[model samples]
Target chain A: MKGNSYLSRKLHSLLGVIPLSLFIITHALTNFSAVEGGSERFKAAVGFINGLPLVNVLELFGIFIPLIFHGVYGLYIAYQSNLNTGQFSYGRNWAFALQRISGVITFIFVFWHVYQTRFQVAIGGITHDQLGMTMHNIATNPLFFTLYVIGVLASTFHFANGMWAFLVSWGITVSPRAQRVSSYIWMVVFVLVSAMFLMSLSAFRGDEFKEAAAALDAIRTIV
Target chain B: MAETTVAKKSIKFVITRQDKPDSQPYKETFEIPYRPNMNVISALMEIQRNPVKDDGNKTSPVCWDSNCLEEVCGACSMVINGKPRQACTALIDKLEQPIRLEPMRTFPVVRDLVINRDRMFNALKRVKAWIPIDGTYDLGPGPRMKETKRQWAYELSKCMTCGVCLESCPNVNERNTFIGPAAISQVRLFNAHPTGEMNMEERLETLMSDGGIEGCGNSQNCVRACPKGIPLTTSIAAINKDTTKHMFKQWLGM
Candidate 1:
């Protein structure tokens, strides 16, 4: 009885890894589409995106509903484990700490992303897929570019780390050898996702690329 | 002053002794014939057999809790050489000369090495870390989960309630009533359950209250310190998202 609640709350948080991770992957793909036609193409993509009733409506339910459930469950489970398993200490406390921190980073990122793109387009009437044109706008502004790169990197790490933890919670990584192997696998996936996401961003930033390429060429000549 | 001898003599074990939970703790040193493979608990057992300190002082046997002997039960945890770990797993050979043992300070000392963990137990209770089934009648199979989701839930369940995590947590000190990482991860675990979704609103509301998830400062010490390797930091992050949505719902009266 008591155990069931504890398990259910934990499971909900674990399931969250799926939706969040999947959302990022889809987002990165959509952003990559900007590399073809730049701003105008990106705007068309945004129109297509906004037109997709299934995605927009589902996204509202997907992002918020699970997020709220996960939060409440996190609080409850944290307290419950504190009770039944009275052996509380730092070494035993780290895993939960990481899960929560990554959750915070992801949440902050989501809010900012939605504000910059979704809200802007809804209110200011965007001329392009503000979300997709992120690459172009970032290319124009170096500060935004740096922030974008960091944000994408952070998202990838959180997603991969979440996936690994989720797997452990689900009892998939059994045996010492298997655990190490799976960790390596998850690491590779994280790096790949991050690199691909960054690549797409860099590709669309045509002017930034030209400047960076010139700097590299100068360094090559000097060295 | 101590002197070194080259002779093939056995090592000595000087252990603290206590009877009941309310009794005063005392020290009793034992000179056990040097055995290569031995632990604090093993040496204590030897002393228990002879019931004599090195100075020929007879005393009551030492007592502690230990199970699995493999470091999983976390019952035999104690301070060895100024660090917390299982006495059963702490081998004599790996320890420095005159190994020192003491009860974990975070908990109330029960006897010699045993301490009361009631505080932590109460913390878990405060969070209501369990699913309410409503009855003893067997409710045939709950909602099914996709394979991917099931795998992750198993990972969060690996927590064994070892206090080492809390011992290392800075937030879990006397100054704060922070519930710590174990409970937070457990919240992530149960909230992931199929039927558990129903009570999600209730759980998020709890975090919004005093001494809840807001206490976390993003120190990230809990992730590196957990022995079970549970993803605590990630759980903390996931909850942040949950809380924000919850807060939004409250704003609109949802």
Candidate 2:
């Protein structure tokens, strides 16, 4: 805790605070775009992302780094916590399990996403993305579509959840009144965003688009 | 029953009594003569000694829990005059005539004033809101916190697992499983310690989990309701920043 004078826990939080949120918002916006433009528009957005000259580096950081840090940091905290805290009661220990599980799910969702969209590289063979082709594939793949829906729902929930959590980490979720208000807000927003994504997937009709559609539907319907 | 009947001046009570948790709770009336500057608990104690209702029928002694009458134990908490607080500390002189007493509904009632506080305790466990320490073996000054820092650390340490905060939180209802604000504040407290920081990321991560910190609705009631005046909202905000950073750190491998 005392290693660097400049880097207290507050600073560590600041490091991820903005960027992690940015990722969620950007991701939400991009996913929402699917409703207006269909797969083609989504791909166009993808094209826009790929064309940015210096953006891939940022995108790479956006895509990979935060996930690693947030998820692993969560695990490390959980691991160390179990060792240190006493044999805790139910309320005390539930968060540790829930956090790790959500982390793992989000992590898996990302890899599966990369592979399905042909953005995956290194783990197997590098799969390049032809924007239009990727778009077509998503429209054509039922499984991918289903996953997208789930991903969207999960992502929004995660973000909404993160909002309340971020407050606490900053030493802010202090008053019971404030905590209640913030959490209720998060709950409402999460459900709304997730529902929007699900509606889109469900509206997509056709065998070719069934998987993608199902994914979207799943996102909306997930309780 | 009349032999043990303690003389009373004239105290009024509008009690919400229920035969069962499912039974539609109804108001019952009682007027025990007032003793000088009596606490709400003392009045209840008098009622327990004489199981007679205002209607003149023998009934069971009113069931409630009270230990350390000083309120540190928090067992004497209940809704008096429509506000959640310690009955033992609620002076009869300050209360309106026909004082209203009801059980704290945020928890399941085992009897009249005794409600299960397992929910709050469970939340603490969920957040891993403690620093691990081995048995007392002269671990001798494991870590020294600044007196300045200890001031607030001690602030958060005052939570007595009372249901006041949870009861005041609108989000913490039957519809949602949101762990109320107390546990969130506790997370901030434990994570701030030198040894406690070892699990900081874990605490942050837990807040990120479903029915975890996400459940907080930020009504700011907990701070207002906390008898110890713990800063519940501030802890939530701090945890918010911490968890986000923790998220990005995990993803970025930072």
Candidate 3:
């Protein structure tokens, strides 16, 4: 295959940084809010987001379009690129491979997450209380919990490592010292975002949400 | 027994041949009387003397390029038994039967075992992969590199632009404009020179542009594939760091 086009590379880099990463960081922080203030706060945050004017448009153009392009283009790059970590497994080489792997995992997880939750909300079949309760019930399932943990890990690593790559690829942190410094910063982000995801998941595991989920199940059965 | 040994001593070759650019490639087999310690270049020369197919048909002599019949010139680089390397160093007895030879596809195939390496040269030009001290008068002795630095720089200096690394690089194909690892490593070499440092920013700027360092996907294959054993991936990592610093310098308006 021919080399990457200027426009494609530029757009890929740009999309990763802009709306996509911005949304990811925000989503992580919002999830952390669930841990900070419980299901009521989580419901308020989700409701505010779901209730925002033109939120559908924002999700479509701001998040989904850019995300799809970044992901598809990333796969194209990964295909055009060779993997040789078997012989030359340097830190950067491993990171390069992990970046692509995590990108794929994150891509699948994002779509599945949206399909499971947001799509239901869009169809008016799920309310804010149900959102929290559904998440609580799903978290109780060992398989779903494991998948969620893996999904969160993949996304956190992808975003953090993607930031590191963007720095060098864009010529932002050219010096080894500067890159090392930036790497330290990205490591912190990795740890923090990962903690945020775990904390959010723990909030879903709480007994309060478990009781709410049980009550909702009883109501559904009766209805 | 001597006559049987003599009759059995023949080198078999399976060569990929393309009559012209844009033409389909076909395979041709040739059997040449073996010589002791014969490299691929000498074997090809023996075939050139006969210019006949193994089946006793008169056909055109096999086409390939070489100079310095030693591995230094890098002109004789081609795929020998599925590996991109110099034919001048590939000995017949060291290779498997029916040794396969093909032109490096990283560059456009010109004819039979020859390819145009203009892509690499163009990249060198783009990165200004040289020192700029041209003058008629005698120039003063340049600054010396530290002994430790000289050792590795000497190693980096061995790249012959053989296109072997490019051929093995997945990112250097026809669809991608990645200048490949050879050029990026050369940038590391040039930027290390005392005089070459004068144009370091310009070189880094070129590397920061399209099809430059950004195109590298860090496959790490270049270092493994390099016939000269240049530290390609290390150079790329080093230059990657350099370009990032250069960008910061530009941002600081330094």
- The C-alpha lDDT values of all candidates are 0.65, 0.67, 0.83
In candidate 2 the C-alpha lDDT for residue A29 amounts to 66
lDDT of 3 by residue, B1-254 (tens): 45554455888899999999899999999988877999999999888889888899977888899988767888989988888899999988899989999998778899999899988899999999989888999798888878887788888899998898887766777566688898888889988888898889999888777778777775556777888888786788788768767866887998
Model 2 / residue B79 / CA error / Å: 1.1
TM-scores of the candidates, chain A only: 0.68, 0.67, 0.92
**CAPRI tier of model 2:** incorrect
Question: Across residues A67-183, which tens digit of lDDT does each residue of candidate 1 receive?
Answer: 666645544434433221223334223434545554555556666766776777668744343344444565568887777776777678767766765554444553435545766
Of the pair 2 and 3, which is ahead by DockQ?
Answer: 3
Model 2 local distance difference test score: 0.67
Q: How well is each residue in B1-254 modelled by candidate 2, as lDDT tens digits?
A: 55686555688888877667677777777878777879988999999888788889887778888888887878877888777898888999998888999988888877777778888888889889888877768566777788998898998998888888787665577755567888988998998898898788887777676666655534456666778888877777777667766767887999
Question: How many Å off is the CA of B67 in candidate 1?
Answer: 12
Best by DockQ: 3
RMSD of 3: 5.9
| Candidate 2 chain B weakest ten by summed lDDT | B213-222
Task: Tell me the lDDT of model 3 at B106.
Answer: 71
lDDT: worst 10-residue window of model 3 chain B: B1-10
Per-residue accuracy of model 2 over A1-223 as CA lDDT, tens digit each: 2232113333434434567766666655665556777655665666666677877688667656766666555443333222101222232123324443455566677667666554544443422323333444564468877777777666666666666665655656545566668778878987877776675555343233445445555766995
